[model samples]
Target: MEDAYTHKDLAALCSVSETTIKSYRRKFPGFIPVLTRGKPIRFRKEAGEVCLKIRDCFEKGMSVNETLAELGKHFTPRTGAAPSPSPSPARSQQVVSPEYLDKFFETAGKMMQGMAALATAQAKAGQRLEKVEAVLDKLLEIEARNGERFNELLTKVGSPSPDIPPTASSSGDGAPSRETVRARKIVNVRGSEGEVRSYALEKEADKATGGLEQPPGSLLSTPIVIRNDQDEFLGVPGRLPLSGFVEILVREAEEDGASLSRWERAGEAWVFVMDLTGGGSHALYFTATTTPRGNQVALLERLDVDGKETTPQFLQEFFRQVKDKV
Candidate 1:
């Protein structure tokens, strides 16, 4: 769990910037933790707990943007709610009716205005956003932490019964074969919509094995030549047959590179996020999560493309169709 979610990890998971997180900590209390006052890491258990609640609140009715907007409404005291309190009450009271009342009030008012301006300014910074993001990250971190403990217990349970060889999905090789097929026509398995057949592996990348990993697919950014059956260059996603391809690459992809989604073997199928930047359209990229149940796993996901939704049933069929064709 923690292994998969470092600062870089959470950034990728939450789709935000790390620097933004650091900035948030400076503004919001414990938004990001610096336990020993060193470099920051995920908030610990307490903050994590709050995050879950905040996120639940957000997901059920608000988006990050919406949550921030709501938070911003609380960003400052309302009109007449509290005029700027002086840094010190004794000094502040003196200003209320002293010789310097008018001057002091004016000066203090300016100072308060300056500070308020500063606080508001900080809030708008990406770092301020990070503070809010940290709240959300907290939930993931908690779940991740629990997942770690569960895995530990499972590992402690030791290998499966000798009679039961753990039946698990195959791992990937992270390599590309020359036989990579150009847009082999794919037809969507969904009952709705038009043909969406996926191009299967033109040739066997490698033979199947119980524990053998398949070569990981090229990263999402790795450009692929999408051609027609005649092998004519059809420049991804434009013109006839909608031929074109763009690989989605996780910024942290390995040397050979694969999307974070496909870097690990989840279950029966390796996954990748949708390369939805125009050319990468058509080939579905996967995002969402999967739950492991004994030897099998099931994903909770939607298509990576904008304005497209997919059911888990469709996802399973799509992967199967790809695997079978490949």
Candidate 2:
């Protein structure tokens, strides 16, 4: 009977890791015949020599196809038949010809040189990609700064100019002008519903008066409450006109002692970095857009904490507080 070797035994005999031995068995299945398919899988003694031969070919810069061809010249591939008895260790050792050793070493040295060059090329490519990534990050930062500046400009433009006098055209009695009186009348017309009705009423007033009325006060002073189709209070509207229903999350965050920094503006969304009291930080993206029903609302578009995306559930309490406060 031929000597049988477990994977570990074969690994020791071939001076390779057990993982490498298993890889050889997988890559050259026909050449490494299993004597027992059970646990601690045992292979024919010849599998050890085959592993060594495959390793030598690989080290000698031969591709799998080339190694298979070379193997065919040295040993008959197993055909799933019972393996014939292999020669004793001494006899097998003597079978390795001197010409094979010389050829193996010569090819392996060339392969090593080629592998070193490939590694150097890969390192250079990796460095180039890192540089490109850095540039993109810088560009994104610049874009965000620009957007923030643009937002500031828009806010400034929306404000009442100190240089311009009131255009109410007051009557001699110092009473409000006819247009102002008409605009105020339009504003006072209340909808059956509470705040939501007022928002609609104000829009009508704006259209009727040709925007002569001063831009409404800060959201903090005159917070307009909105609701969804389900009649749930969505929160107070923000002053960002372009965004339909912008919420005043910044005010809420600031009240909680969270330091906030404005980041980039992505589309209609403004990204902010909020640093909490616990020394943790989060990326909060607030998207301002008009609802299909023509309501302006700010939404918490996305939230990221410590570089990981998370559900807004973390801020549910904070949001609840904002709603209650409003």
Candidate 3:
């Protein structure tokens, strides 16, 4: 039987807080497999192997986004849930028991193993399969410290198999690809009443205090570009698209005398608490989501800061200074 572990085991192995693991689970949905769900979540032993890699990436100074991208190479989600092997006539009549569940899981593991083998065969012969083998080996570990937890969590949630979609980097040797980090376009924005303001992103040199540059597109800030209703070039939403913007926002908040109480990757967004200037604290959200227009948009919001809602003017000023010195 493949080994199973709890959140505590993964945290201790990765030298990260349990909260951090939960954040990883939320942010990178398809990356790790949850053997059991609900409170006090349990993970497959393979999770620990992946966590170890994540820890190494962080220790090497790679950001959360970068770490996930790196992990994409070795970990590939199965197309569908693992299929159960054919049962014998007598076995079919027998009542399902713990041993039967273990056998079923074993079959699923073999399915994964077959897929991995096929991947190896597709790769160039004599290629260094160190990383791939290591991940598979760790996944096949027989430690079952939390079998009961798995039984319960899986009982509540139908199947144990994950249904995450595969990424471009999940196949082959996992070479770095521009497709993995493509810049998402944010063409235009529509207000509450469908009032639209169209805009385009243009690259420009980062200037000190220069207002607008020619071509009406160059923002002269970070690689990201966005404009307001008045066609005034605003700074990048956060700094870069996705989590990169979150990192910049965190740095800016800290530099602006906001003490960071906590930060975590929340679902498709990054949520963090900032004790702002003048002895007040607020929750800051850096969210990236796909717009209805098929473009990705990065949004920054301050929630209930000092008992005051974030105003439109405040957002405008915030965007203008998002990349003040950068």
Candidate with maximal lDDT: 2
RMSD of each: 34.2, 20.7, 38.7
The lDDT ranking, best first, is 2, 3, 1
Regions of candidate 1 where Cα sits further than 4 Å from its true position? 1-100, 126-128, 131-191, 194-198, 203-326
lDDT comparison, 2 vs 3, better candidate: 2
Ranked candidates (TM-score, high to low): 3, 2, 1
**On residues 193-249, what C-alpha lDDT tens digit does candidate 3 reach at each position?**
989975433222222112121111111111343445674444353435433544566
- The window of 10 residues in a row where model 3 has the poorest summed lDDT is 213-222
Task: Write down the TM-score for model 3.
Answer: 0.26
How well does each candidate superpose onto the true structure, as a TM-score? Answer: 0.19, 0.25, 0.26
Whole-structure CA lDDT of model 3? 0.55
Can you give the lDDT of residue 290 in candidate 1?
26
lDDT of each: 0.38, 0.59, 0.55
Q: Against the hidden true structure, what lDDT does model 1 obtain?
A: 0.38
Q: Candidate 1 at residue 65, lDDT?
A: 39
Model 2, 1-326: lDDT tens digits are 35999888988887889999888866666788789888878888788788889889999998666677677778787787333344466765677877999999999999999999999999999999999988966864565456656444434433343344344666899875554532111112345676432211112223222333222222112223333446454554342221222234555556677654345555655565656765777675665444565544445556678767765555454445545554
